[model samples]
Each structure stands twice: as C-alpha cells, then as structure tokens.
Target: MRTRTRIAPVALAAVLVAGGTMLAAGQAGAAPKAGPAVKATCYGGAKYYTSTAGGGSSNAHWPATGTWAYTTSNCNDINVKSDVSLSVKVCFKKTGSCNGWTSAKAGVWTVVAKDVLHGSGFYLQFNRTSSSKGWIAY
Candidate 1:
C-alpha cells in the first residue's frame, strides 16, 4: 500500500509536469497573432494607403509623392494617421478646390475632410511637423 501510494503521486506529478511542458511548448511554437486591420469607408466602400509624410503648410496642392492610392469615386470623408500630430485636407484635382485642413493626432485616425468636391477626382494633402510617414483611409 505504501509503494502504491508513492507511485500514484509520482505518476500524477510526472503527468502534470509533462502536461505543463506540452502546453508551454504549444504556445511557443504557435504563430503570433496579428493585430486587427485598420479599415476605412469610401464610395466603392473602403480604402487605405501608406503615404510619405509631408511637412509644412501648403495650399491647393497635393504632394506628388504623398499619394499612395487613387479613386475615381467621390469619397464621403478622408481619414489620416501619422506618427506625429498633423493636419490634412482633400482637394479636387480638376476644380483646384480644397476642404479646410483638420488636425489628426499621433497614431490616430482623424477625419480631415468631411466634404470632398463631388464629381471631381481628389487627392490628399498633409501639413506635418516632421517628415514621418502616415496613412490615409476613406
């Protein structure tokens, strides 16, 4: 009876140790889960793009290098994200008109432009303190 009791406890301990090791190994071998994707809404429904950060206050012009994606549809609004706090706006390509610049906080989505010029193709403009990269979604 003494031997049997010792054996049972030893077996249980072994089983528990092996189970814990397996659980830890499984977790270590598993692939890391990714964060939720950033999504935005547009006319055709949603869009996003990584763009070069623009610095300084410029008017009536979208940076030639700042655009990452383009659409023919009229987007309801423009959202921007950056490493630094900044301002952004949207402009009609043909009409040469632009909405007022709005502030976007660091690493957050800010509705920069609420009204884009209808029936005209549009692009984004940024006025940042630094040249850090940013994202635009609509």
Candidate 2:
C-alpha cells in the first residue's frame, strides 16, 4: 500500500512536468506577425543635371552620383542598427536631357548600404543603358 501511494505522486508529478514542457515548446514554434512599413516624407533631397534629349529616361550618368533626404520619426523597431548607413533610390525614367524629378513618378527601391555600413554601394537599372548607382559613408 505504501508503494502504491508513492507511485501515484510520482506519476502525477511526471505528467505535470511533461505538460509544462510542451507548453513552452509550442510557444517557441509560433512565428511573430509581420508589421506594416512606415510612411516617410520627402524631408529633403538634391537634384542632378542629366544630358540625353527628349525625355529623362536614362540615368544621365550610367553610374551617377546623388543623395536624397530621409526622415524617420521612429526607427526604434526596425532592423536598422545604430550605425546603419543609408542609400535612397528614385526611379525616374527620361529620354535625353531631363528636367529632373517632377512632382509625379515615384517607386520603391531596395535600400542598401551607401558605404559606411560594410556595403559596396547601391545599384539599379532603368533600361540596358541609362542606369544609376552611388555610394555613401560616414
């Protein structure tokens, strides 16, 4: 009778421990939901002179050099580390000599390291010829 009493407690303890372990493992397997991308304003930017002709379709300079303004009210949650660098790209297509970025024409680009952040630079293409690329560092 004493052996039976001891066995019952041990079996109960084992079951409780197993249940707790499973609960922890289940939580670990769940993935966090993705958040939305932040909306940024055109805090400031620079304009570059291009030479081509009818419309500004080409990058003027295949490997052009330029910089744009970026202001993030809150960057606390992003993967951007304290020492993160910056490289912003705007896709504006033209033919020959263009007037630069108009009020319209905007697109998303793969923001990469300008220079400082252990990155070579940012490169993108419009067509086979007119393309834009540059580097940034601090």
Candidate 3:
C-alpha cells in the first residue's frame, strides 16, 4: 500500500510539470500588436489659427481657450514669429497676463532639417507662403 501511494504521488508530479511546460510554450505564440503608420512625406510640424476681430487688443489680440483665433502661422519666421502666430497670447507686459493673445486653431512648431527640406519635408508643407517660411526658429 505504501509503495502504491508513493508511485501515485510521483506520477501526479510528472503530469503537473508537463502541463506547465505546454502552457509556457503556448504563451510564445500570442498575437502581435499594431502601431502608427509610417510617413511617406517629410515631417514638419505647424500651428493653425482662425482670424479673430479682437484677438484681445487692436495691435495684439490674445484669444482665450476655445476662441476662434488667427490662421495657421509658420514659426520659422525671424520677425516676432513666437509672439504672434500659433498659440500666441502675448501678455501686454508679463508672460502670465493674457493681455493681447491672438487665438489660433492649432499651434504646431515644426523643426525642418536641411536634408529633410530637400526630400520628404518639402511635401509636408507645399502650401506654406514665402513669408511663412522664415530663417528664424520659434
């Protein structure tokens, strides 16, 4: 009887080990995950804004959140590009004050590399204006 009991325990252990091994092997064959698409065009980020009558002030207009702002602006300009276009909300004085902030649809500041401009980057922003394309880095 003791011999029989010992043999049963040994058999049960072997079966449990085999089952565990099979479960581990099955884990390796799980499904693969997906991701974002690859871009065929050169990448250049920009911000777009809708024109506002007031913005905030006569010269400088700062639009509050959810406000219809100015048109899309290119930050690559040298002449105060950072202060006007995009999500530009220039304080009449300090940075915290939303004094004269021009509202924009979306603000995107893209960095265009020299090589990228010649290739895929060219296609990203073909509709941009010459004034929009500036040497300044915003």
Candidate 4:
C-alpha cells in the first residue's frame, strides 16, 4: 500500500507567489542596460558613417552626403542608405585594397554589406556618383 501527501490550497498559493517573485527579481537584474551614445567623425565629403570598436558598433555619423570613407575594428554589420544613385567599396584588410563593391540605383536604401569586418579594420568607401543626396550607416 502507498500513501500520498497533498499540499493545502493556501500553502500552494504562497509557494507559487514566492517562486514568481524570485523569478521576477532575477529577470529584473539580468536585463541589459543602455549605454552612452557613440559619436562618428567623417573626413572628405561623406555625410554619414559608423565604425565598430571594442567589438561594438560606434562612431556613427548620420545624414552623410557625397564620397566618404569609414572604418571598423571588428566584424559588425555595416549599413548604408542613399536618396540618390550611390556606390560602395568594401576593403577587408586595408582601405586601398578593395574586396568588393556594390551600387544602388535611384532613391533607395541598400544594406550594402553585412559583418565583413576584420580585427585590424575594414574600410568602406561610399561614392555619391550622382545628384545631391544624403545617406546613413549603422
């Protein structure tokens, strides 16, 4: 023969509430916090740019126009957009030695490339080969 023990309703409710509170507290502490914003600096005519540093994306310049060059310290997503015809060249190891290039026609946003960065740095050359327009990167 076997006997079973049942928990009282009040006791079960208390246990559940305690477990839920513990879980809620743990979740609250585990939540990620937002950090300070990164600032991007640009040279040449390029209007917007973003670069990766310390394994995080930083140095973001927005509303960029004309030709510009950007760099990244690690493998991070590089996004580019334009309101006019534009072309981009990606350099894996160095800026001068380009690995690939892509172009966007008319006024449209293009992803350009994704996670093509290296530890040393990857260079992006955005050439606004058309009318006056603006672009952004992240």
Residue 51 shift from truth in candidate 1, angstroms: 4.6
Error of 3 at 90 (Å): 26
True lDDT of residue 131, candidate 4: 31
Residue-level lDDT for 38 in candidate 1: 20
Q: Give the per-residue Cα lDDT of candidate 2 at 113.
A: 20
Question: Please, what are the lDDT tens digits per residue for candidate 4 over residues 32-96?
Answer: 33111121321122245332211133222222323344434321345455555656655544544
The whole-model lDDT of each prediction reads 0.58, 0.31, 0.31, 0.46
lDDT by residue (tens digit), candidate 1, 1-138: 999999999999999999999998886565233112123223235344444444455332243554433442434456666667767777766667877778778888677766444454667766643454556555
Model 2 per-residue lDDT at 16: 95
Instruction: Give lDDT: candidate 4, residue 138.
Output: 33
Task: Spell out the clash pairs found in candidate 4.
Answer: 47-64, 47-65, 48-64
Instruction: Quote model 1's TM-score.
Output: 0.47
User: What tens-digit string does per-residue lDDT give for candidate 3 at 38-127?
Assistant: 111111333332222332233322233333222222222211223234433322221233323333332333332221111111111111
Tell me, what's the RMSD of every candidate?
A: 10.1, 14.4, 16.1, 12.2
- TM-score for candidate 4, please give it: 0.36
Q: Write the per-residue lDDT of candidate 2 for residues 10-108, one digit (tens) a residue.
A: 999999999999997775554222223231211112123232211354433222445322323332111111111222233323322222222212222
Best by TM-score: 1
Best by lDDT: 1
